[model samples]
Target: MTDAQDLDIPTEPLPASVLTGFLGSGKTTLLRHLLSHPEMDETAVVINEFGEIGLDHHLVAEATEDMVLMNAGCLCCTIRGDLVETLRSLYRRRITREIPPFRRLVIETTGLADPAPILQTLMSDPLLVERFRLDGVITTVDAANGEVTLDAQIESVKQAAMADRLLLTKCDLVDQDRIDALTQRLAQLNPAAPILQVENGKTEPSSLFGCGLYDPASKSLDVQRWLKAEAYEHDEGHGHEHHHDVNRHDERVRSFCVTYDVPLDWDRLNAWVDMLITLYGQQILRIKGILCIAGEEKPLVIHAVQHVFHPPVELPSWPDDDHRSRIVFIVRDLPESLFQETIRSFNEE
Candidate 1:
């Protein structure tokens, strides 16, 4: 067995994204559309099948062999070992010129898979983390059955909660009223993610990728767009209050922002965050924040998916005149009052 710490970390990490959703949520359909796009020319794909007999590979239109180069120039492959092994193999092949040069990678998870574990694998595995960077998460929502699925399945709710982009599929089959209601429900669960209607799984590739703090095109930190604090503010100002429903599947999941006007003490804030994640990591689905520290010259960017946290990066300057520290939390079964109180206690000390 290979020891995790013994593996070498790559200097230049490849950007990779996860495509996940519930069963029959149109993940494969959307993937087929993406694979056909010219923009996905230098991309590699990995599909994970759940049962003994794997059939997801056949569902992809142009996928034929273990590694198939589609007409549009993208490469498609199934998961060989696990997610980590597959990523390592891809990196090794790219290094040795065994495969075509690929710029990005996309992994499709089984409908029943919890996105958090895959995300954790991406961030936690030392070898994988060094070679592959988590670009973002794209979740496909079945508009026709989204509402019912969300109400009946907890896994479906989790997929939406952890998504960076929520793509609504099968819009043509559903009425506008149903779509609107489902949209509202999704917003309550994950206010920061932009929901786009994907017709027949066709969507602009630009919209799905580049969702992380580091912009692949500009090679710079696009903190404002990535944080999306303005969206949270707008939702709050417009009285888009999130109501907790007793009967809904995501009744326990909530999205809210906690703001601190005073500049935070770096050491104190770090300690608080460490403790928070240690205690309630499972409940804290996602965390993104911009902080103005008392002694720091630039704003600090923090991102966490469940218990795993990316190393904090400091931007050259603040995005705007607003210097207040804003931390947005998307949590499940974690009360806003508890979060507020914990922060308040930290600030007081």
Candidate 2:
């Protein structure tokens, strides 16, 4: 009974972390300082307002309204029916445990939300893509008008080109010649996240959760940095990027793939990758994939950002076996026809 009891490994605990930014960029003052620390005991917030999930989080006495508003807080504005009914009511209260078995799930989008169609409605939700696993996207940049709010906002430069950690908040109202030219314009706009600064909204939950999801061998949350954001690099050119006419923030955020040989149904292939990044997530900036649904043996990865998505990830095997479901997107003037109409509308659903 020792090779780790032969081989089971899934104790049950890894799912939360979404939090985005743009409007005043502080994200509820860093969720009131991470619900007063102690590693956010039993954390489970949802707060997405503009239509529903918002109530000042009951004056944040450590949050809970099961909030998930969607009348405008841009989670791809009315995308595939309010992101599949807020992920089927947060995965049916997390599988009949009926709430509170939670150890994580802090959603919080809304400042014109677009965390890639709410991380592809939590990675192509068929039912929260095999329990739940995508813990990356933590944006929030401001550092006193974050470099002219990334040049008068393009959804604050697509929330800093779909971040994985950019924090930066106020920084004592800027002045080290404006926080060194806003940290050299965020290292020329995201050179693979890791830019923390914060001052008023405070920082440190281990510099906001270990990226790569969170897995120092099981501290959890590392789906290869929310599905390997092509190991990162977007250089800079976003004037609200276009695509085909070219402008993945001024070029080369390229990552292309669109396989098939069949096996889809996973929520109409995430509603055509959330209506093709809600009509070009500002130019299909960075998308990721690895799906192979149908009967499900292993392989179901999907990540997005022009329409804000990041949730589907299911792999218990076959990092190789050529199962076939790969999706990789990254855009700029739509061409691969919404990635071939998002896997041919999952064969007409």
Candidate 3:
């Protein structure tokens, strides 16, 4: 919440939300409520249903045929063919103007699905990485059963840890003391996410969204918060903040900005972007920067949503005389070594 005078507001497109949770976490109920919002009418939904019956579709009444259902149920396991192929087809439809030009796409992953692999598909796939932007991740927790679920189910813990927003549903069923204790435990698990209450699938959409790459209203981007938890309001657990587990995607995403003193060789910069976006772009959730090269007074801006990066934009004038290229990256399961190695390799050339 910087003051207007100090803020460097952004002007970019908003990414869609990725809602996930364990079974009975009320993810479908939340989606049903979200889709009911007048603002969500233009949103296309992709639901991953796990069971043979696949009754989740019947639960969502707002979406038309716009809802695409994946039969395998888990995104990580199904995406190699089913997930990737389906998303690719959807991309063509959107770009070719075949569909209603959905402003947002909500991918509702199955309760048991792991998010990292799904994120990987979105980032690695050439057809998708650039075409669709991952807005944010929202995870719902059963207020009454969360502690037990977290204790017994490691996947639920992972889901909660990675979420940008944590919704505690069934609040009416739990007492105040129990809710307070649950919040305390959740703080230890993942304090970076803001906790919101939901009863009967009713809550404000605004509180649940805009936790992604760019802030729609301000247009200003905060890479730290988007990839990691810098944008969150609280940090209660020192252990969770420094959790060093290196699994495919354990909510320990980290982000930082790099500055260059000299104006970059446009060709070199482009090459770096190409190599990184191609090699590990899927690992990189978001990348953006303002380039200040030697010859140009105005900055060259680069932005990427998932792996689909938009073309660079040359600003009308220099925002300031810093004359340093500044780029920020939101990377998941990415070590600082990757950035170091990339920089060293780029400079040796």
Error of 1 at 10 (Å): 8.3
TM-score of 1: 0.87
lDDT of 3 by residue, 1-349 (tens): 3344543222334266778888899998888988889988778888888866567878887346568887654776854468778776765565555666676778888888766567656655666655665666788999989877876676677677657788999989989998997787665455456788899888888787777544445545443343332332235653225433344233445555556666678877778778887888666765657777657766776767455666676666554445567776656567755765676567555
Q: In what order do the candidates fall by lDDT, top score first?
A: 1, 3, 2
Let me know the TM-score candidate 2 reaches against the reference structure.
0.31
Steric clash pairs (candidate 3) = 10-219, 10-220, 129-307, 129-308, 130-308, 263-293, 263-294
Name the candidate, 2 or 3, with the larger TM-score value.
3
Candidate 3: residue 49 Cα off by (Å): 1.0
Candidate 2 per-residue C-alpha lDDT over 1-349 given as tens digits, one digit per residue, 9 for 90 to 100: 2343343323553565688888877888888788788877666676766664555565456445444444444565654466666656665664444555555667777777756666766666665656556667788888888766666556666667667788888888777898877665664455456677878787767667655433434533344333443333233775333333232242333434566767887777767666666766677767666677887876666665555575554555654456666554555446655566656755663
Model 3 Cα shift for residue 110 (angstroms): 1.1
Question: What overall lDDT, based on C-alpha atoms, would model 1 receive against the true structure?
Answer: 0.79
| Highest TM-score scorer | 1
The positional error of residue 280 in candidate 1, measured at the CA in angstroms, is 0.8
Stretches of candidate 3 off by over 4 Å are 1-14, 215-218, 222-349
Better of 1 and 3 by lDDT: 1
Root-mean-square deviation (CA) per prediction: 5.6, 17.2, 9.2
Q: What's each prediction's clash count?
A: 0, 36, 7
Q: What local lDDT does model 3 show for residue 275? A: 84
